[model samples]
Target chain A: MEKAGWDGFEIGAMLRTFDGAIQNIATTLPEDRAYSQSSSFTASVADWRIEKPLFNKDYCIDCQFCWVFCPDMSIISRDKKMIGIDFDHCKGCGICVEVCPTNPKSLLMFPEQKDEESALVEWPKKVKKEKEDEVGEE
Target chain B: MSEIKKIKNLKEFSTSADRFEGANLLCPGCAHSIIVREVLNATNDDLILAASTGCLEVCTAVYPYTSWDASWIHIGFENGSTAVAGAEAMYKALKTKGRLKQPDRVPKFVAFGGDGATYDIGFQWISGCFERGHNMMYVCLDNEVYANTGGQRSSSTPIGASATTTPAGSVSYGEKKNKKDMVAIMAAHGAPYVAQVAPNKWKDMVAKIQKGFAAEGPVFINAMSACTTEWKFAPEDTIAISDLATDSLVFPLYEIINGTELNITYRPKNIIPVRDYLGAQGRFKHLFKKEYSYLIDEWQTRVDAKWEQLQRREEARV
Candidate 1:
């Protein structure tokens, strides 16, 4: 999900180079990603989501392959508890689908469709019975 | 060398906030992004990243947009380390003078650049950093060529792999010279820690990074990153191709401590020929032809020789 709501943080002091020398050498504030870009700016490029992972939690033994291989880190893991993919930020790299080592893959990439049924919007609520009938049937 | 913080499993590794928290515009299957993630995950403390002007810098930080969650600075094409060295110097000075607010938890300084910058353009700065004994880690995400700048051949590009500048149409057989032995060169600098890691090998990669972080003096990690677009490989093959690279011994996993103690991290059970790794990528597709069979042999000979040399070094350490 795009974590929206501008928290108007001040842009920190920036290092500027002039004539090959760094200027404005000061103890600057650490950057708050909110100032410039939503750390979840990947959500803005939603069109980049060509494909989305269909997670079969039933088959997921929580091997954590999907979590580790995800370049975007869109796969959320809380306190060592592996959770579902955050589709908003997932650029549909399908790396999770490819790296899924399960027999009946816990994660499989499907073409992202506009329909809410096939889309990951309902991923958390989409039951195992329904997923088996649709994706796991193959 | 610091005690290698072993990641018990993948679950433990995934718990951290993704270092490159901002959305990056790196190509879909770029291994450089994965390498960046691993580097970020290597430490949990605050980080100050200094990046050179390459794929990582341009794609991640496009004015008013940034993919980095950590404090990052990009100087010039040839001064990733120089910038980081200055930052680290200032941090230490302020901390020593009790001027820094957070003296207890000073940030770790890391400099990252592609092979073009590391093996070529920024070599002088990197050498000076090592000689000057800067308290920083320099990571070279070596994807062979200058992929960001239209796939130009760099010193790290392997022989017989076609690149934009070194086209392999009729007479040319891609890059002419061997990939620069950067690991050895860094070790020669008397670095406290010098390692060569394949991004796909997560366990070894994480350990090497932790060790590099722990080292008291300068550290260097030459991480072999795969380029899906430039290499013309399927996005799915990113991990598999790098796995093949290590298995074939084209890319070995090892660490050099204090420039003398050598440890070969992973030796494949069966050393597959380099053809398996080469045949999978389009850049080396020309070398698969029957006429180019000799090229494969030449490549294999070099890889095997290097493996033997590495093995000898590891054995000598005992």
Candidate 2:
């Protein structure tokens, strides 16, 4: 889930109908989660996996309450999109999940026991590019 | 006058005469002059002023016409705390090194800035200075708006008041946010002395200023300054507006010592409706509507809550 890159064009279209990025993110999630939006978006279960999805939009208010108060910068914004879990770096501390202001959690930690399933995915391509750029600058 | 009072002791040092005669850069009837005058009268100590860039800065220190009688430094907007904190540190360093002459008579340090600097831009630095235990007085001359910069809204501007930035138009009614509780913010940092004063009542204001300066540690005084030019009220209405504020309890006169003891000074005999205060300023004309009565109610609720909390604290202290 952390490695998946969002379709920017589709997200932009969804934003016209929704007031906030969280609502748009809810729409793209697999229907099996049984999410619904009634005044505010809500999910059926308190599943931790659904919370860690990337929000690739300009919805952050930049209150910095999140960053300043966040025990972990796990809910990070890269190029203005809310991305989650640099898996190697993430300690699964669950602090990011706790501080998020969204009614339904915005960033969640996948259970540590599910290591085999989580390791099956590749690291985000953007993360690789970022490392390469840093190397070039050095 | 009745039998003239004589100077007996330190208490007899009080005077009715204004010390800020030709030096005041504030406009006629401007509330800053009242505060400046009171501060001047309270002490003869050689002063070092750290002034933030605002109305007081632009008006008083404009080119050659400096209204400040003491040695003054005009730091950039929003860094009054850092500048004053540095000055305090330097003074302490010089004294410790035995480089400062007549150390006992060395100037008292003060940082003066408008609400914009104190409540918003310089809040972090102000908190930092307070926590570090700087021995100085920080005065926030709160006229509610960034008046010198063309009537823009500031963090201290009351809700439902209109300004250039928070203008009343079709889409919006007025400033959507409540005025920032700056005193509470300072108190949260564990400042030793914190007070709010209105200059219209000279005696009360003068007393608070003297006490604030005499405090052993960092002190913050939020003076309710009236800005005629920006509020679009008549210059002569400055005192009247200030009086209205107190009468309405919109801007109460109070003090907090070490974030514990709460003291209410001069509670008005007659508490008027908030409308009377609002009616005095053009910025609140938009709030005359029936729908906006809720805003007035909200203001009253907040005032009542604060007053009750203060009373409770005062009782607890006793």
Candidate 3:
């Protein structure tokens, strides 16, 4: 039996499977990051809102409600089984706080405070410049 | 002027000042207002509400200002079913334990959320609740997208519609998928009561809500809501746009009973083209062009087919 070279049928099958694998990966990947390659991330004023769920780590059963229900797809499951918020995409809508079914309410909302900086490192240059101008005026 | 009659007895129609004043967080012209009003108007019974996080939750329960008049709990988006389920369990347990004030009359429990939370995120939990036969009304404000988060597309986004994620740009077509048949899915679960009402039609909406609560088991209401922010339409046009939806037969106002019986509440006098409805909203602007026009036509055909099927069902019953 001759060892098969990269024939059209074999290559096509491989490519099809490869596409499926990519799709599976793409679906599981975070929505914000999934489109990062194609769409430029524009930082708006809404990004600054403090919408993190106040998680009482003690009561969390790791049900992953917050992670799954996050509309922005901002919550990330860390290796240690801990779920963290991707503040960049999180609108701080307190959805996590509302959904936490823990006895003491594992996730709660934190009041908007001035000191907390957003996790989104690459703030849009125009928005950043606008902020600087506002600060200068102040 | 003849069609649009002013609601008589404004004084009698006045809702409780205490209820829904601070709890609701809906924008002006939002359909959430209509739903909230309907629920509040229907029953004064001590009700436990489980609100799934979305536009409704964000606006109503933002910090201290709560528009919810009844006892409300803001649960996360997906677990509306679970949370309401939990609330029902707690309410039942309390009744049995003699802790609940009105043991004979159990507190009504209603779970409310937007399309994203209900159709997509909370589907499993909702199914669980229905399967377990929870005494609750699951109200899904079907605004068609995740309107709260800058208009991202949800499973409920109509085919050929534009959203933040499904932008109709050069790189991609509009939402290349059909809306998940949420009403059918709910009906399949053997829900005792299922209804779809447009928020613009206040009387029909109010009546359905009242009927839904009176139901024994789980009742699912897919409310066709107007999303001014997401639709990129003027806030003032919210009512007009919602009215146009039903007029165009894009969203037929109807109720389904016991998953089998079909009852269409209000059919428009003159069924307008789907284009009239689509033209009203900016989200569907791409469909007017040549390439996407065929796609829009296909979608309209699907809508017409569904409407015909519904009509046949209604006729068979008669």
User: Local distance difference test, per candidate?
Assistant: 0.78, 0.62, 0.65
TM-score of every candidate relative to the true structure: 0.87, 0.65, 0.66
Candidate 2 or 3, higher lDDT?
3
- Backbone clash pairs for candidate 2 read none
Alpha-carbon runs more than 4 Å astray in model 3? A1-138, B1-12, B15-18, B22-25
Candidate 2 residue runs with Cα over 4 Å from true position:
A1-138, B1-25
Best by TM-score: 1
Candidate 1 runs further than 4 Å off? A1-43, A114-138, B1-6
lDDT of 1 by residue, A67-101 (tens): 66677767777767666767656777677777776
- Which digits, one per residue and each the tens of the lDDT, describe model 1 over residues B1-318? 223434778877766556575356787767888888888877766788989988988888764456666678888999999999999889878877889875566567899999999999999999999999999999999999998989999999889889999999778888888899999999999999999998788888988888889888789999998888888887767888888889999999999999899999998998777888888889998997778779899988898899899899899883
Q: What lDDT would candidate 2 get against the real structure?
A: 0.62
* Model 1's DockQ score: 0.23
On TM-score, the stronger of 1 and 3 is 1
Candidate 2 local lDDT, B295-317, one digit each (tens): 77777788778777777877886
Residue B213, model 3: lDDT of 75
Candidate 3 CA-lDDT value: 0.65
The number of the candidate with the highest DockQ is 1
Q: In CAPRI terms, where does candidate 3 land?
A: incorrect
